[model samples]
Target: MADSYMDFTSPNTQFTYTLSDNPFFQKDAQNVINTLSINQLNTLGNVSLLDIFLSKDNVVEPHIHQNATELVYCITGGAVVSLINPYTKELLNFTIAPGQVANVPQGWWHYEVANQDNTHLLAIFDAPVPEVIFGSDILRLTPANVLAHSYCLDEAKVKDTLAPITDTVIIGPPASCSKQHPNGMPMQQMMNHGGMNMAQMAPGSYQQAIQNQTYHYPYRPISGESESYNAPLDHPFHPIPFLYRRWD
Candidate 1:
């Protein structure tokens, strides 16, 4: 999938990724990644190959992939992958450091964030068919009302906090990968101050939420404009999830 804009023969092997940018993901981590994909391995199957990733911390956020099961291997350092079981409000969690793998069933909500250094991990899907939908993109790129409604946050607050979804803690901004935003601020402070309140990835949430009414928003868009025709109410158009590929 190489275009004139993205040639790999002289690829920036420093970051082995090319083509397949997304409507919601970022692609500036070329320095930290070495991603290569094999188009199709077997007999016209969905077997796509993913190269190893030097996982970064904020890359962690809750997300779901619709059509595939994923297995992740931690090559170094450590990571924490968790999920809230919909049936029980308790979180099913795991601490994955070096030389270990975590298995996540498909269609479940999950997310992974790296530790202090350049933690490495390899992701292998059951069918080499996997789609990554970053949380920042989903929250920032989707219609404003949809973003707020999906997470049950006040619409005003969503706007005040999200400037076309600035570099989120999920993935560091352009300058560097540190505990701070390239925009200038500490990440823990950002999340603690509410960068990502609904951020939880316990891949194990295919079960329905318990009837507590304490968790999860009602996910309802005020009856109007079908959520498709409504424009960004007079704002500079920010191309969303321009970070990576999205199947949504």
Candidate 2:
């Protein structure tokens, strides 16, 4: 258990907090993230969570939570969580539906893509506050000359390609982005042109590829079972045992 130096005997101690009041990132109402941490609820130990809502083809940009491991639980609809294993340098993808979860080890580069509309995921972390390093920030902040020299690419092209990324993109492609694909081809059309390996494609293309149903995921479901499961929207939130039970 995480030690807390709070004065529990004090009347100022807070026992309840509304997570929605604390917004982490909002990419419009449909694609928004609400956060909860020890800062918001002083009684909390070493735990935090992000309530994520995403629409179809929406992505939670690739990032790393350096301080804690994240367990993404699917509450409604479905999504694909992809992570790159540092040890093996392999990209692993997991398709999670309602009642399922995908875990990302601490410091691992990973991202999530909503496969269906009204997808809701709860990202729980083992730390009081989750610190992240987003891919967009790295790409945008890195000097174009440095990247070009390191990758043996054209400096001008690198600058042009990354110029549009003005800020941290938590959910993307940014709302202002007009082009969905690089070559002016729709994502589905590109996938239909020729089946390709998702691992070989750039990180930005993963969401579109997965949405088009072209990328093959590693895990396979039981033959008799359905490929995907959708939770009813009438009851959006599930009951959490810890919330109702007294720890004492």
Candidate 3:
């Protein structure tokens, strides 16, 4: 059956959208995400996407898409898409380079980490609007006393540990974070010494490290000029119309 809700003859019917103009979250010039949903394009049917750009060691952060299943496609550079399998109770990691892809089941906990500079990923969803529950929100919003009581831990320590997380961290560690590697080792150097397996640690280890506020992943410094670009948001919805030129 055709889409009965959509008015095909209406002048307001939109068929094209520029994802670059819409910024969903921007950690920095190197780390940013733009989103597109049915709201942007009225004719869309249960489809949405996020245009993600990241530098080395930058993470998309652990999150659950309760409303959609995600298919992550790598466009440039490389990334590690990690997800937790609720059935097997295993943390699975998939390293994808250009032309590779990873699929995350709906409601599964997952995250993506850029393994190289200029990593570009497109996260396509099966929902019109992907709803997310960020791990940072879970950690920060939950009552500290309740968490301490449930886990049999110190309440003050729990509160103190989570104090720094004042808002939803879509991408982390946040730009305000000042934590650095004690040994001053570059991420590439560390990976070379021990391989990428070192970064694929268990979730508990990550949680403990976060609680201690010492889990800062080292990134190789960008040599020469940085090619980071942030699209201006002042006029995101107003895209210039493209005119097709006839070949002579």
Q: How many residue pairs clash (N, CA or C atoms closer than 3 angstroms) in each of the candidate models, in the order given?
A: 13, 0, 0
Q: lDDT tens digits, residues 1-248, model 3?
A: 22467898999999998987777777779898888988788888778899999988777877888778999999998988888899999777789999999999998998888889999999999877777767766776466766787899998877766665555566665554432333566543333343333234433443454444433221221222222324321123322121111000
lDDT of each: 0.47, 0.69, 0.69
Poorest lDDT segment (10 consecutive residues) of candidate 1: 209-218
Error of 3 at 17 (Å): 1.1
Report residue 26 deviation for candidate 1 (angstroms): 7.5
Off by over 4 Å in 3: 176-180, 183-248
lDDT of 2 by residue, 1-248 (tens): 48457788989787898878987677778998888888888887888889999987778877888778999999999988888899999777788999999999998998888888899999999988777767766775566776787899998877756665555667865554432454565432333334233334455554442233321112222223443435321122311111110001
Instruction: Name the TM-score of candidate 2.
Output: 0.73
Candidate 3's clash total is 0
What's the true lDDT of residue 21 in model 3? 72
**C-alpha positional error of residue 114 in candidate 1 after TM-score superposition, expressed in Å:** 1.5
Per-model C-alpha RMSD: 12.5, 16.3, 14.4
